[model samples]
Target: MRMSIGRRLSLLIASQLILAALGIMTSIVAFRRLTHETAYLRHYVFEPFVVISSGIESSNALFDLLARPSSDVAYDARRPMMELRSFVEQYQRDWLTATSTLPEALHLRAALDRAGELGLLNEELAAVDTIAAVVASLERTTGLVGPAPTAPFLRRADVEDLGAALAKLNKINLRYMDVAYSAYDRNRRLILLAFLSVCLAGVAAASLFGLAVHRAIVPRVRRMVTAVQRFRELGTYEPLGDWGNDELAVLAHTLNTSFKAIAERDKDRDRFLAVAAHELKTPLTTMKGFSQVALNQRHDAAVRDRALAIIDRQATRLARLVQDLLWCARISGGERPFNPQAIDVQELARRVIGEIEPVASDHSIRLMPRGDAHILGDPELLEQALWSLLVQAVSVALEHEPVLMTIDADSAGRELITIEVRGGKDLPEDLDRLLEPFAVIAFEGRRGEPRGTGIGLHLVQGIARLHGARFSIERRPGDIMVFSLELRR
Candidate 1:
C-alpha cells in the first residue's frame, strides 16, 4: 500500500514537536535547579561574619574597670590599668578587622566605654588594702592608726560611687549580649528554614519534570528506534504514534515517517532486483544453452530444427521481460489503463483455480477456491493476478503435502477475498523478494527450478494499482502463507 504525502508530513511534524518539547522541558528544569542552588550557597557564606563581632564587645568592658584604684587590692593598680588599656586597644583593632557574619557585630559599633561594676569593686578592694597598710605604717612610726595622712575625707563614699557606675556598665554588656545571641539564634533558624524549603522545592520539581519527560517523551523516541530496527531487519514499516502535540511528539512523528519511507524504498529496490534477476535468468539460460549446443554440434537438419525451436522459446521469454519492463514504465508514467466492468471476482478466482488444478496435482498439491464475490474491475487482469498467485503456491508446495488455496468473501458483499496458499513449511526469510523475476535459488552454474520470467506478479501489482486495490503478503502457521487483496470499485 502507498503511504500518502499528507500522512507522512503529519508524522514528520509530530516527531519534531516531540523533540523540541523535551529540550525545552530539560532546560527549564536545569535553570530552576541552578538558581535555587546559587541562593543556597549565598546564604551559607554570610553566616560566619555575624559570630565574630559579638566577641569584640565583651572584651572592651574588662579593660576600663581596671584603670581606677579601688582601695581594695594589694596589686599595683597603675601597672594593671596600663596593661588593661593595651589589651582593650588590641581587641578594638581586632573588631575592626574581624570577618564575622554575626548580626551583633553590625549592631555594636561604638567602643571605649567606661568600666563596669566588677572593675569598680576590684578597684575598691585594692584601695582598702592600701589604706590598711598605710595605717599600719603610721602606727608603727607614730603609734597612731588614725586615718593615714592627707586626703582623709576621700572616704569610702568615693569607692561606693565608682562601684555603682561599674555596675551599670556590666548591666549594659549583659543586655547587648542577650540581644545579640537572640538575633543570631533566630536568624540562624530563618536561614536553615529557607535552605530546607529551597532544597525540597528543587527535589519536587526535579521529580515532576522527570515524570513528564519519561511519560510524554521517552516512549515516543524509543518507538522511532524500534521502527527503524524493524524496517532494517524485517522490511516492515511501522508508523510512529503521537507523543502529543508537543514538540517531542512532532519529532517522533517525523522520524517515523522517515523510517517508513526509507523501509519502503529499500523494499522497492529488493523487489526490483529479485524480479529483474528471475525474469532475465530464464531466457539467458535457454538462449545460452541452445546457442552453445548448436555451435558445438554439426548443423544437421534435425538439429537445426531443434535449435530453432529452443531459440524461439528463449525469444518468447525475452519478449515477456521486455513487455514487463514496458508495462512498469507505463505505469510509472501514469498510464494506468484499467477500465472497470461489472464482473464477479469469485468467478475469476474459480476459473484461475481450475486452470491451475492440473499443475497443483502434478506437484501433489491441493488447490482449493471458496467464496461468493463480485467486483467492478478488469476481469482479465484480476484473473491473471489470481493465476500468478496459484502458480507460485504450487511451486512452493512439497512433493506429498497438497497446497490449499482458500477464498472467502469478507463482509457486506465487499468482495473481500483472502487466498491462503499452503506450501512448504520452510519459508525464505526474503519471501517477498522471492516473488521477483530471476531471484530463484539456482545452482552455481545451472538453470534453477520453477522456470519462468518473474514479471507475473509485477504485472499483478501494476494491474491492482490500476484498479486502486491493495496487495500484501503474510505468513500463517505450518506451510500456509496468505496474500491479502483488497479491491475497491
Candidate 2:
C-alpha cells in the first residue's frame, strides 16, 4: 500500500508513544507488587515473631513464679497467666487473617498444597493452640492455690510439658519466618528481572524503530537534495531512482518531468540560435558583396544599378527577417500589444494581396472573394499573419502558378470567418512541425529564390493565437497546399 510521508511520520510517533506508555505501565505494576510484598513481610512474618516472643516471656515468668516458694510470689501469677493465654490466641488469629487477606500468601498456600506440603501451615496453627491450652491449664492450677504459703501449684511433669510446647511453638514461628523471607527474596529477584527485561525490550524496540524510519526517509531526502544541488551547480539534471509510493517519490517524479522539459527547451534554444545566425548571415553577406560592387568606380552605370538593386532586395529580406525574430521574442515574452477593432475581412485580404503581389512577381496571386465577412481583431497582426501565409504559398508555388486567397463566412452556419490561402504545391508531410519556431519546410517545386527564414509561419501562428483564431495547414484535393485561419465574426 502507498503511504504518504505524513502518515509514515505519524505512525512512527504513535509507535514511540505506545512503547513509552508500556514502559510506564510496567514500572507502575512493579512498584505496586514490591509494595505489597513489603507489607506482607511486616504483617505476616515480623509481627507474628514479636507476638510469639512476648508469649514466651510470659510463659517463663509463670514458670518462675511456680518454681519459687508461694510466700516469695510478690506479683499476681494469675494476671501473667491470663496474659499469656490471650497472647497465644491473638497470634493464631493474626496468622490466619494475614494468610487469607494477602493475595501472595493465598497463592503461596495453594502452591504448597500442590507440592504436598500443606501441613506446614496447619502445624503452625496447631502449635499456637497447644501453647494456649498449656497456659490455660497453668492458670487453673494457680487459681486452686490457697492464699497461705504453700508449695508451687504446677506439677513437675506439667512444667516440662509446657516447656516442650513453648519450644515447639518457637520453632514453628522460626520456620514460618524462613518461608516468608525465602518467598520475598525469590519474588524480589523475579520482579526486578521482569522490570529490567521490559526496559531493555523497550529500548531495543525504540532503537530498531528509529533505525527503520531513518533508513526509509533520510536517504531518499538526501538523494533529492543532492540532485537539486547538482543541477544548480552544473545546469544538468540527473533523474532520481524510484524509492516507493510516498510523497518524496511523487516529488522526485515531478522534478524529473520538469528537468526533462527544461533540457528539451535548452536544446531547442541552442538550435534556434544556430539557425538564426545562419539566416541573418546569409542576407548580410549578399548585401556586403553587392554594395562593394556598386561602389567600385570602374563599374559601368548599368552594372552599378544592377548591384544596387540586388543590395536593396537583400536589405529588404534582412529587414523582414529581423522583424520576424523581434515579433517572435515579443509574443513569447507575453509582451505583444494587441489593438483589436472591427475589420472588413475581404478588404484586409485585398490589401495583403496587393502588398505581396509585387514581391511574388513569378507567382500569380488571386483573391477569390466570397460573401462579405467582417471580424473583430488586431488589424496589424491579422494583416501580418495573412501576408506571411501568402508569401509562404507564393514562395513554394511553381512560376506563374495561381496562388489563391479567400475570405468568406463559414459554410457550417457558425459565426466564424475563414481566411484561406491555397497554392499549387504540396506542403511538407510534417505540417505540424512548421508551427514551431525556426522549423524549415522544403517544398518540391521551389525555385532559386532564397529559402525562408522559417520564422514566418511561426509568427503567423503566434499572431493568430493573439487574435483568438485557429491557424492550420494541410494538403487538399488537386495536390494543393492550403493555409487557413478560422476567426470569430
Specify the highest-lDDT model's number.
Answer: 2
lDDT of 2 at 27: 79
Candidate 2 regions with alpha-carbon error over 4 angstroms = 1-94, 97-102, 110-123, 135-264, 290-317, 335-489
Model 1 lowest lDDT segment of ten: 109-118
C-alpha lDDT of all candidate models, in order: 0.52, 0.70
lDDT by residue for model 2 over 1-489, one digit each (tens)? 656777767877887788788778877887887788788778766776687677777767767766666753434576666667678667665565324555656855754555456677777666666776676566556653335334436655655666677778778657666666677777788878887887787777767767767777798889888888888789798988865688878888988898887777676567667766866897789889978887884458998988887777667667766877888889889998998898887788888777666556667777776665777788888877777787677666655778777666766522232333344344457788777775665444343434554577899889878977788877767666778877776
Output the TM-score of candidate 2: 0.64
Give the TM-score of each candidate: 0.36, 0.64
The alpha-carbon lDDT assigned to residue 360 of candidate 1 equals: 46
lDDT per residue, candidate 1, 1-489, as tens digits?
A: 333334445555555565556555655765574554444333422332342233223223223434555453322223333332343343233332123233333333221122122343344334333433432342322222344443222223333333343344334444444444454455556555655655565556556555555555566667777877887788777777664565766677788778766766566567557756665776788788887777777457678678767777667546645765666567657775766798876566667666555434454434344455566887766766777666555555545445555555656554544555455454457667555433442212123443433455566666777887777667778657776667774
Q: Residue pairs in steric clash, candidate 2?
A: none
* C-alpha RMSD of each candidate structure in angstroms: 17.3, 6.6
Top-scoring candidate (TM-score) = 2
- Span of ten consecutive residues with least summed lDDT in model 2: 413-422
